[model samples]
Target: MKLKVCGLTKMDQIQELISLNTNFLGFIFYEKSPRFVLNHLSLEGISAINHQGKVGVFVNETIEKIAEISEKSNLNFIQLHGDEDENFIKDLRKNVKKEVKLIKVFRVGETFNFQFSIFNSLVDYFLFDTDSKAFGGTGKTFDWQILNEIEIPIPYFLSGGISLENIKNLQNFVKVNMRENKTLTKLNTPFALDINSKFEIEPGSKDLEKIKTFKSLLK
Candidate 1:
């Protein structure tokens, strides 16, 4: 499984995450977030970082802005974490660089309906996170059992409230899913695990040792 450490801010922490071979380093572009990348690091500064898995998180942002920021920040992926519909995704796809992968986020609440036909061709990946009014960084987990109810066509990143304490629950869930006859043979397990607030010492500031230990435990 891949590990994506999101809401990164400090350069040193970014370097530490990179050193740990973190698959994706996410930078939040949403201004409302306390861990907003722009508030801590300059676009040029982020652009200069030599990492292939740099991701920019946006919430209901304009296509123009997403395009510009993706280019300026040298983002490898654009994570759309809001109420962007099929048309919005199509438009954004046309505007951004072809090399840049798009990861459409679905905030899972009490009930979720997987209608992925419209998005199958538009995005490179799908992210399933806990639903929240704040868009993200709520650090609250949704019922993982909800995932067992659907057949996800595309490989997705499981996000929200992931930490050392609850890691075993995910492991057990995956084990059970593996044995399920209904699980699609064509669909693989979750592509990655996206973690944010739970590993942070504070908003945007990651606890290096905790993350290091989490990775070690996961392995």
Candidate 2:
């Protein structure tokens, strides 16, 4: 499994994660978010980071704004963590560069239908996170067992309240899920683990030692 360290606000932290070879680096664009990247780093500052996995997370933001930021920040991927439906995604897809990938987030509660054919063609990946009134960064876990019941067609990132204590459990769960998915060629398993609040010392500030330990254990 891959690791995605999210809610970054510091250049040193970003460089540290890059040195650790973290798979994805997430930057929140939503002004309401406590870890909103613009508050700490300018668009040019974000773009200056030498990494390919930089992901810009937005919440119901306008297509033009997202495209502009993505371009300015040199973001390779875009994560929509809001109520963006298929039509909106279709329009955004057309507006952005063709190489830029899209990750549509699903804020899962205790139980969800797990039937999301509407976005099958619109997005490149699906990110499952605990439902939050605050739009994620809740540091809470939804029942991941809920995913075992269905077949996901594309790769996904599992987020929400993932910490050092439960990281092993999550690894075992993914192993089992992969084994079961082998028979179905079209089925997909989690491609990455997204960590945020649990590894933070404060909003937007990450604890490097905790993240380093987690990475060692994950290996």
Candidate 3:
């Protein structure tokens, strides 16, 4: 299971997350989000780390702005947490040629349904998060059982309310319950465990010891 520490803001917190050797570090670009990184930080500041690719999180942002930021910041990926259509994703891929990865986040709720065909051609990966009108950083856990019913085409990251304490439980459950399921294996699917609010002292600050413990457990 790969760990992605999202909602990064401060340089110190970024350094700490990098020290954990987490696979990915996310920077929220949505102004409405509490974890939003200020524009002054620049792409250089965010990309200063020797490890972990910097991801820019956007919500309903214009393509021009996303392009400008990707160019100026040298961002490795774009995480679209908005209600973007397939056309927008197609355009983004056509415009950017850095083997740019796209992570399309889906908000899970009782009414949510699995619709992979709509996005299968557009994104490199899919991320499942708890549904909220306000977007991510909800700190709420959705029913992991819901995944059992859906058929996804691409590799995905499981998000929402993941902490050190529950990671092992979740991993065991997925392995035991999903191992024999043909639909899951048919896609050649790879899943990553995404950690967010559970390891944080606040929006951007993470507890290093907890993260270390989490990494150890995963190992």
Candidate 4:
């Protein structure tokens, strides 16, 4: 599986992940988040990074602001992680460059109903994260069994509480779920694993050794 390392703040660590070929590097735009990228790096600073998979994570942010940030930071992808409705997304898509990919996030809690029809046409990808009052980065995992019940059409990123302890079992989990949910054959398995807080030594500070070890195991 591809790996998306989220909540990045340090410049050196960001370069390290790029050198490691991490598929996606997430930077939080929400001012409320402890891992908010602006707290450590400026938009110009982020734009200077020579990586193509830079992702900007926003929560209930205005379309104008998202577009402005994307432009200034030169983001390759945008992740909507809040109660953004269809109209919000449609308008945002129109305002942003067509080459920039859109990822709509769905928080999975006790139960989840995957409405592929509602978002399939609107976004390039979907991200399923554990439900939390904090928007994301709760360091809690939802029931992976819930994915088997949904009708997933596009590729998705599985997030929340994914750590070294659980990384090895992820492949098995996907295989078993695929077998049990026969309809899943029509859809691809998770395109990537979105990891954040679990790999961090502190908020916004990732443990480089842990990430290296995890990547080695995946190989």
lDDT of 2 by residue, 1-219 (tens): 888999999998899889989999999999998999999999999998899899999999999999999999999999999999999999999999999999999988978775587898899999999997778678988888778876778889999999998987887887878787686544556789899999989999999999999999888
- Roughly what TM-score does model 1 have, to 2 decimal places? 0.95
lDDT of each: 0.89, 0.90, 0.77, 0.90
Model 1: per-residue Cα lDDT over 110-186, one tens digit each: 99875866898789899989888777767988888888777778778999899988999988877776777344543
For all predicted structures, in order, the TM-scores are 0.95, 0.96, 0.90, 0.95
Candidate 4 lDDT, 30-113, residue by residue in tens: 999999999999999999999999999999999999999999999999999999988899999999999999999999989986
Point out where model 3 deviates above 4 Å: 182-190
* Candidate 2 deviant stretches above 4 angstroms: 184-188
Return model 1's CA RMSD, one decimal: 1.5
Query: For residues 6-77, what per-residue lDDT tens digits would candidate 3 score against the true structure?
Result: 877778777777776778888888988877776436677765666646778999999888888776767777
Total backbone collisions for each predicted model: 0, 0, 0, 0
Worst 10 residues of 3 by lDDT: 181-190
Query: What RMSD, rounded to one decimal, does every model reach?
Result: 1.5, 1.2, 2.2, 1.6
Off by over 4 Å in 4: 114-116, 177-185
Winner on TM-score (1 vs 3): 1
